[model samples]
Target: MWKRGVVIPGARMQRALEHPGTRRFSLTLLAGSDAAMRVQDEILLARLYNELVVAGRIHKTTRRNRFKGLDRIIVEVLGRELPDVPEIALHDVGASSGVTTLELWKTLLSVRPGRAHASDYYANMLLVRCEGHPLVVACDEEGAPLQFTLGEFVFSAGQRESLFRPCNRWLQARARARLPDVARVIAARKEGRTLPSGWSVEVVALWHPACRLAAAADARFTLGRHDVCAVMSPRWHFVRAMNVLNPGYFSPERQREAVRALAGSLLPGGLLLIGRTREEADSSNVATLFRASSAGLEAILDLRGGAENKELVLEAGKRS
Candidate 1:
């Protein structure tokens, strides 16, 4: 996850930096809904799970899974592709809050703890998340989220009418005011004091999750504030750019450059996986796998979400 203050070399777009002609290769963009968006509808919440907070007056927006297609063909592919090496290094691009990132690591480690033929290859993995601007965290003075309590309910005893006005009105009109209402928020702290009412929300300092995670100082995992456009690291075995690449966030040329940067960060014959997803439970996503070669990155597979897609959608690289 990318932090606000930490400086990561090459994380920014250095227009002065240029890719040599030899390194620049051609790539064909896959059409249709074949890859996923970085699918995390629920980001790091401002407050802890137990804290009482909501997304201001309006409800929060969640559109996709934190990680796309984790339980589907992806795992199968990983099991088959990942060598039984002693340690596997993965670069999870655009890892927000590290929920899906950490979960994926745990699943990978736990799935085959003692493979009969698998090597003891298990070690630290890298997660990179960064954007051009700063991340806004709604944490209180004491470090808890004040603006948006991540996991807390939105409704309170006082604001029940506003949040659930429709339902309440329906019940009154029908003369059968039944059916339990929305979950109410619990009392929470505000600026080091207990909030008397759940609706007493306020704007506290922005508390980005990257800051908290960075401070933890975990050795098993290292955080890098990296920009996908200019990743500054040695090549790796695998790189997953989940839900970050699209014409919407960046232009076509910049999109190509982003792919180039991610591909450059891979070792020869390394695997570069790109995906974007929407809708949490559907798990239906689009994924593209490319291989880094002397000729540049070549698409090897196009997964259109769900468990059905297993065959490789091989695409020939376009060379200028």
Candidate 2:
């Protein structure tokens, strides 16, 4: 019997398992299997990620090897422009699960040594224990809470106080009834005691095969939270923002702000790669590469006809 809110290994899981290529990324599986345990962690992480996306309505999806063609171009550009720079610094924004980030990191390292930083607005999930009861909270890049979870019950930042909202009342009531300590957990959180007595909260990253592989001792790689819209000191030699600056995700004004902020975070003559991949069988990568300069971003290369919203980049450059 499946527990409430537990994702069952249905057709999708079976299909992935049958085909070895996607089994590790499957979100549904038998609860006791090793792959299932890993997938359970992923599901929890996804729930937390989804909470932030739903609240902010941001388009921050990612996948492994999504930048196969684009990464080759990036490496080629770096090798040509800064061939002698022994250590290049690269930042991957909105690096969901860090899969593609790691992929790009390894690809770049193969050609030249560099430090890779993977960042996302929603990066870590906190599992808090209060008197043996477990509660999970989704935290932003700053460690601020965005959503809370008790057992199968997940609620947004302020939804706890307004559990009677017409759309969520029934589900909220049922979860509350099953896990009465949810009230205690909330009360404790209000008092800043997320854990009782000697218990400590555990922080877990979104599980991915690539993330696990990167966990090994490597001074060249780091992971953290960052909101691209915020001002940041210029540091990186290369910055990649894939599937993040989409017109569907942000308003024209917000996209302009993000573009400027990203452009501002580049060293003189640094490169900014922004684009998205199609969902077709080929997963064609359509993006634009810009070189940052004193004046503004100068388009240097376009892959598969450039980014779908290259006008936004141009508009931002005009105003910058």
TM-score of each: 0.45, 0.70
Please provide, for model 2 over 1-320, each residue's C-alpha lDDT reduced to its tens digit, 9 standing for 90 to 100.
12133234466545534553411221122113244235544443443334444225553456556777678889999998778887999999988778788888899988889989988876654444445554444443344445545554445543443433543445444434533343444446557775455444455555354565575568688887788797788998999988888777778898888989998888888899988787654678889999887788888899989998787896696533
Best by lDDT: 2
Instruction: Name the top TM-score candidate.
Output: 2
Question: In candidate 2, how many Å is residue 207 off?
Answer: 5.4
Model 2 misplacement above 4 A: 1-56, 127-169, 176-202, 207-209, 212-216, 280-282, 318-320
What are the runs in model 1 whose C-alpha is more than 4 Å off?
Answer: 1-65, 112-218, 280-283, 305-320
Evaluate all candidate structures by whole-model CA lDDT and list the values in order. 0.38, 0.65
For candidate 2, report its TM-score. 0.70
Write candidate 1's Cα lDDT for 105-136 as tens digits: 55555664311110111111111111331212
All predictions: root-mean-square deviation over Cα?
19.7, 6.6
Question: Using alpha carbons, what is the TM-score of model 1?
Answer: 0.45
lDDT of 1 at 280: 52
